[model samples]
Target: MSNRNIKVVRVTKDDYDQVCAITPPGQIYSGTDYLPDYFHMLLDMSNVEAYAAVVDGKFASFFLSFVVDNGRTVVTRAGRTNKEYAGMGLQDVMRRNTIKDRKYDKMAATSGAHVKAILDQIKSGKREKILMMEFRSYITSGDQLKSILNTIGNTTPSSAKPIDAIELGDILTNQQVSCHLFPESRVIVDWVPYRLIKSNAFLIKTIRTTVIGSNLENGTRILTFGNYFNTTAGLVCNIEVYGCIGETLAEHLYLHLRELISHEISGKVIIRCFYRQETKSNFITKLMNRFGLDITEIWGTGLVCTETTPEIYFR
Candidate 1:
């Protein structure tokens, strides 16, 4: 119960069920069903590392990281603390320990709080700045997609004509998609391959075409990945779209999403968009408003901090 009594250790196969048991529902898009599978997969990978806080020999909090880009980068995939241990600061313990032990040129994480928690640790001298601090936005939807489209009105410019969109599957298979979507300096850790995308956790029911345009040929491309769940509300959807696709393509994607989930589902459609900059965030916010979707939450402020020289912050 006391901070001194708790221990932070590397997660092992024996800890799998315990971790799953403590993972709160709705913390992730696929919910609890995906937790075990995901951690198991990570456990098998040589590049992956996971840590947990154990109190009285029981798992209290955990964090997951992956060594990406051939040892040049590290990404914090996810972290959560048990509701029972909410105020214990277990997350800080695990995070600090992992960053101290893991050496990499760059680091990244997708968090609702952006990276502010980590920034605070760095500022207070609790942790070292291994990489620059960067924030991104995650947006979810509420209203009907069609109404939003009508409100936005014709997003496509007259000079740029719509081309036959590609299948979502094809886009997922393209390895270049990640590089095309994210900034060159940022290290992206959630680029799910096509094979994994088809799995149950990522059970993509309806993947509408990826709209393309002539004028925005070299511009942003929207890549969507999400899963559906049968909750108390019915078949709820969590669609995560990544990229800086402008208004026209955004409207097109939402139209397809609306059409796919319109029938036989009483649950709400939650569309999450991750933006690397404030301009893009504003752009997506406007689109969401037009569609009648309220801005449920915004995470990652798109700020980056870095250390000019490499040094260990934790020992």
Candidate 2:
């Protein structure tokens, strides 16, 4: 039975303003929402599909699905709705319609309270937990960076440097980097998870991110993928870290922080870090103890703190 009040339809560039304008609450994934920036790019792709729930002749919610990992999975993102239509169930209606059209397995990446909602949905239906990672968001400023700068104390930065597309693709494929750094051979980029494959690495290049990591050599571990975007909350410094936990990981984090400081990133900086669960305590511990600051601080409000991002499969 079709509901006369609402209908799900594929979106296009013409729907950009309607979709991007709907700031329901919190954010889509994390950091600055790439939805507004990359929506057109997604629409241009033949394999990608973005759908919106038009309720009573108005765009109510938006969702995007992109095939990845040799078409084995469809990553669903850019999920949100208008606060005006909050209890209307537009998001669910749009998501269900979109999933029904997808032939491959589906994945939903969410955090904090949204993660629980996704998990709850999975329990009721057919969904699998692909991966789980911890996210720490800290509001920092230049003054704060100064306070922590002294704690590092004559520490030289690691060999971590910016790599081009080719180099990044190569580094991600390194056996050690893929096995140890990446959990289940999945690389988390800007909070979106992708398999440990060169193709995905190259795909990220379109996002124009700086892949910072060193060449692995005998137990060596280092990987930092970071990119910042303009937001009302100030410059959002979004990043993901994949490295050996504890001291080594802390050092790698500092390397990114130190590099960030040099750019003199203006305004309140929301430094969001995504890392594995087992390493969070020790990693943040050493980071604070060594650098006098950490992203482990509780997010007061405004943004939803997605504790675990689980990818639910439709197939």
Best by TM-score: 2
Q: What's each prediction's TM-score?
A: 0.53, 0.75
Clashing pairs in 1: 132-305, 133-303, 133-304, 133-305, 134-303, 135-302, 135-303, 148-290, 148-291
Put down candidate 2 lDDT per residue, 29-75, tens digits, no spaces.
Answer: 44356566566776876557788888888887787866666666566
TM-score attained by model 1? 0.53
Candidate 1 lDDT tens digits, 1-315: 553569989888888877876765455433323355456656776766789888878788888866554555556666778787888878767766766755666554433334566667668764444323222323333344544555655554443332332443344344566456433423322322112121212222223222333233345555444343343222333344445556554555554445444545443544444334434456666766555655654333333433311254332
- Point out where model 1 deviates above 4 Å: 1-17, 20-23, 26-46, 83-103, 110-116, 122-184, 187-245, 255-266, 278-283, 289-292, 298-310
The number of the candidate with the highest lDDT is 2
TM-score of 2: 0.75
Model 1 error, position 244 (Å) = 6.3
State how far residue 105 of model 1 sits from its true place (Å): 3.9
Error of 1 at 154 (Å): 18
